[model samples]
Target: MTYTPPAPAIVDDIVSKTKFDANGLISAIAQDTKGVILMLAWMNADALRETLLTGRVCYWSRSRQSLWRKGETSGQQQHLIEARLDCDMDAVLMIVDQTGVACHTGRRSCFYHGVTPDGLRDTAQPEISTKELYGH
Candidate 1:
């Protein structure tokens, strides 16, 4: 289904209130409608603007120093359902309809490790294989 974005003025108003860090980035967390946390990423102003304008979640790739559109390569697109900012406006919580796995490792979520007495342990298995997702 095609999702329409909010009006430009509304998008601008929302982006304007966001508080990005010194690096011009803010934390963005994506969750499913079921309240399952999917992944955490960063977003610059441009990324935020694009996301709000397009209904597709876009993030900042700190390592690549460019806008990273989710699922661009992995086919695991995250369609924005709703976006909410924290009280401080330093972070955004995005409720999304994920197309596929949300993690590079082909897991349902990026948060797969659990802190245990034996140190971190894998709490979930990958639903899809990385090789099938990335062709590596």
Candidate 2:
């Protein structure tokens, strides 16, 4: 579906309220409509603005030092359902409709490791192989 962005003024107001860190980044969390946390990433102002403008999830790639559009290569796009800020405005919560595995490991969520009595363990298994997700 074609998603139309909000008015430029609205976008500006929202962006201005976000408190990016000294590195010009803020934590972004993507959750499904069912309230299942999918993944956590980082975003700069540009990434957040683009996500709002395009209705697709985008993040700042600290390792790559660039804007990363979720699922750009893995076919796991996240369509934005809603975007919200924390009380301090240092974090963003994105409600999204996820297309496929959210984790590069091919898991449904990035938070698969769990601390248990038996030490850290994987709580979930990959739904798709890494090769299948990335064509690597």
Candidate 3:
């Protein structure tokens, strides 16, 4: 789906209200339409702006040191339904319509681990194989 960028006045208000961290980043929590948390990622000011502008989930890749648009390579795109900011504006919560899996490991969610007596354990299994998702 194509999304047009919002007006300059609206963009200015959003940027002005956010409070990015020392690294100029904010934690963005992505949740599915059913209210299940899918993943946690970092977003810089530019990432936030692009996400808001394009209605696509975008993140700051700390390891790659660049902007990472979710599902750009894999077909697991996350279409943003809404973007919410925390009270202090230090974090963001994104309601999204996720296509396919949200995890790079081909799982529905990035959070598939649980703290158990055996220590960290897999709480869920991948719906699709990573090789199938990434075509590796």
- The lDDT for every candidate, in the order shown, is 0.93, 0.93, 0.90
* Pick by lDDT: 2 or 3, better one: 2
Write down the TM-score of every candidate.
0.95, 0.95, 0.93
Per residue, candidate 2 scores C-alpha lDDT tens digits across 101-127 of 899999999999999999999999999
lDDT tens per residue, model 1, 1-136: 3557889999899899999999999999999989999999999999999999999999999999999999998899999988889999999999999998999998999999999998999989999998889888
Which stretches of model 3 miss by more than 4 angstroms?
1-5
Best TM-score goes to which candidate? 2
Count of clashing pairs, candidate 3:
0
Candidate 1 residue 82 Cα shift, in angstroms, is 0.4
Clashing residue pairs in candidate 1 (N, C-alpha, C atoms within 3 angstroms)? none
Off by over 4 Å in 1: 1-4
Give residue 83's error in model 2 in angstroms: 0.5
Model 3 vs. true fold: TM? 0.93
- Order the candidate numbers by TM-score, best to worst: 2, 1, 3
